[model samples]
Target: MIAFEPTEDQRLMQDAVAEFAKATLLPRTRELEHARGVSEDIRRTAHEMGLGLVSVPEAAGGQGQGLVTTVLIEEELGAADAAAAFGLAGPGAFGRAVIELGGPERAAELLAGFAEEGGWDRFGAVAWSEPAPCRTHEGFATKAERTDEGYRITGKKAFVGNAALADRFVVFAQVEPERGWGGIGAFVVRRDNAGIRVGERHKTLGLDAASFGEVVLEGAVVRDADRLLGDGGEEGFTRAALRFFVKHALVVAARAVGLSRFAFELAREHCDTRVAFGKPIGHFQAVAFTLADRAMDVETSRWLVWKAAAAWDAGQSERDALLASARAAAHAFEATMRTADDCVQLFGGSGFIRDLVAEKLMRDAKQLMLAAPTAEQLDQLASAIELGQKLDPALVLPTPDTQAIFT
Candidate 1:
């Protein structure tokens, strides 16, 4: 049996984050969406409130919390503004990776700057995904060569979060050739480094307020001090130790569930108020049943998130079963997106209009799917676990012989 009861401290943190979201973040989301940028005031507020550095270690410069806490807080922010929600994902992921993978000197240096004295805010972004022949770390083509100074990296990474705004990037590059396992390594590259350029800005569907664009690195020089995980070794051991996939995915799942909850509440409110023919529309079984089903899915997924998060923190060794947890979360998120669309349809023209925020939530849910270790990937992992074999990192699924699995 799995349980998701929050401790007293966690409950307090959740309430505080929810209150802050309602009072400060939610109101400005619309304006920020139109502006496509977060103001310094908002950043400062988040920093002072300890929102920006929540997962970072207290030893260096963070709150020293775990995944469950991070997910809970992100849910409140995500419901208010998806761009802000998306913005935090990178910083949180990168912060953990740095703390776990970076050498002591490098970790200390980066974390201190992240603490942000007074009003100066510093955020970290990871340049992991790339286009063509290389979609993620498994198919990485970027390379870093050992030079007299340190390392010179040259590669193009697309869809790098906060590319335009971040002070430093945890650049992922291939360090070993053809021995075939140095898969990826992270190097801390500063914005002012020579040959490092922020490419075209993209106005994405939902996270338009957050900076989304490409990062081009041409012979970007990195000193030995900047080299984080892998340390010129195969397998990128340091990075793998960080376990970012589960951490980021759980927070993302929480946000999707939160948005769906908001949609459900709005739909219920609308059903009770709007009358069709004689009585309230909610009295109709067809409308009420669909709402009830969606509500159950949201709650179930939310609890599952909490369970997996707890397991991950406790260092539970359920490798074979963990993939299923990720799959369940993905299904829940997908269901929310579908249900939110239905909510829009139920509201008729009013839903389509810019008056209600349901349409935005639907769009936000769609955009969240862009984060990596996609649903298809999760399915592949499940397939591998079922087959009792180590899944090839590069295997694309539906497995060609899809019939074989069923037969």
Candidate 2:
């Protein structure tokens, strides 16, 4: 009974993003890779196209696209370059959380600034990961104690994505040492906030252009207005945080699917033209079958991502099952990576060289696994299924008007 066909509007949206990615993004991959940072031109083009603000609701002065649309755009950009796609998509995710969780005045102020600026120089990076025992915010060593002036935050968060250029971070800290994540609440910490410091940029095997660093807070002071959703001492912030985590996970999955497809096409082209034994190598069963399997995996991952996004967009509370969709995607992505590596092997030595596109594609393919919860963490997500627990509540966003904030 479910319809899989995308509407006319959806198709148009998808094509538009794909065109932008090919025309504006692909050409810049090498430049970004070498520069090790985002390019102003790419950012400007994304801002002009409204891609930087895609997830912001229309009321918030953005395109108001849902996760499905976001992923579609993400796929195109990711096919071109993962870091650039992330630079475009990560901010939108941050803005969405702000609109849903921050105070009205603060949210309006920030959203207005975002609209005026076209796009933020730094992307929105959520600082949630902490050292052991507090993994996933279940417990945290960071503390944000209420003070006479506001709150004094003291904690350290590691490996925050986009931390280098992030203007502000959504940070989780405990008000009571006894509360753990339950006692945990979120606050907005600005780059210049007292005692807030961004640490050394780290290099990774892939997504080289994507900025990763640490956020340190030592006696950092933030005003009360900066407190997110549950500042009134409720679990709303935790709810909002989980929703975003799940959404980011989906974005990662989409990027994996896109890059895999890109690799498949490249392999196919090689097979058709590269003569082997006086004929195209594609005639060989090994190469042909591998490509076919890779295509199957890519298509399957794409389907799961689309379904997951649609579920979230429709406000379906049953969307928790979509976590399974994310895991399926991770597996498919792994398969595609292996296939792409094999395809590169099919290319002989050309695949290992710098001029060949397959080499870069292989590098980017490895990056998809590290995005967000990582493949290992995503695999743990399936544990809920084993425990006979539902993932639905994990996917739902908290309705803003359902509770009184400063009451």
Q: Any idea what lDDT model 1 has?
A: 0.68
How high is the lDDT of residue 176 in model 2?
64
* Regions more than 4 Å wrong, model 2: 99-109, 118-122, 131-138, 230-238, 318-325, 332-336, 390-407
lDDT by candidate, in order shown: 0.68, 0.68
Error of 2 at 135 (Å): 11
Q: Which ten residues in a row are the worst by lDDT in model 2?
A: 398-407
Q: Which stretch of 10 consecutive residues in model 1 shows the poorest summed lDDT?
A: 398-407
Clashing pairs in 2: 320-391, 320-392
Candidate number achieving the greatest TM-score relative to the actual structure: 1
Which digits, one per residue and each the tens of the lDDT, describe model 1 over residues 261-368?
777777888889899989988889998897788788777877777777777667776563366456655665676687678778778788877777778777777776
RMSD from true fold, candidate 2: 5.9
Clash counts for all predictions = 0, 2
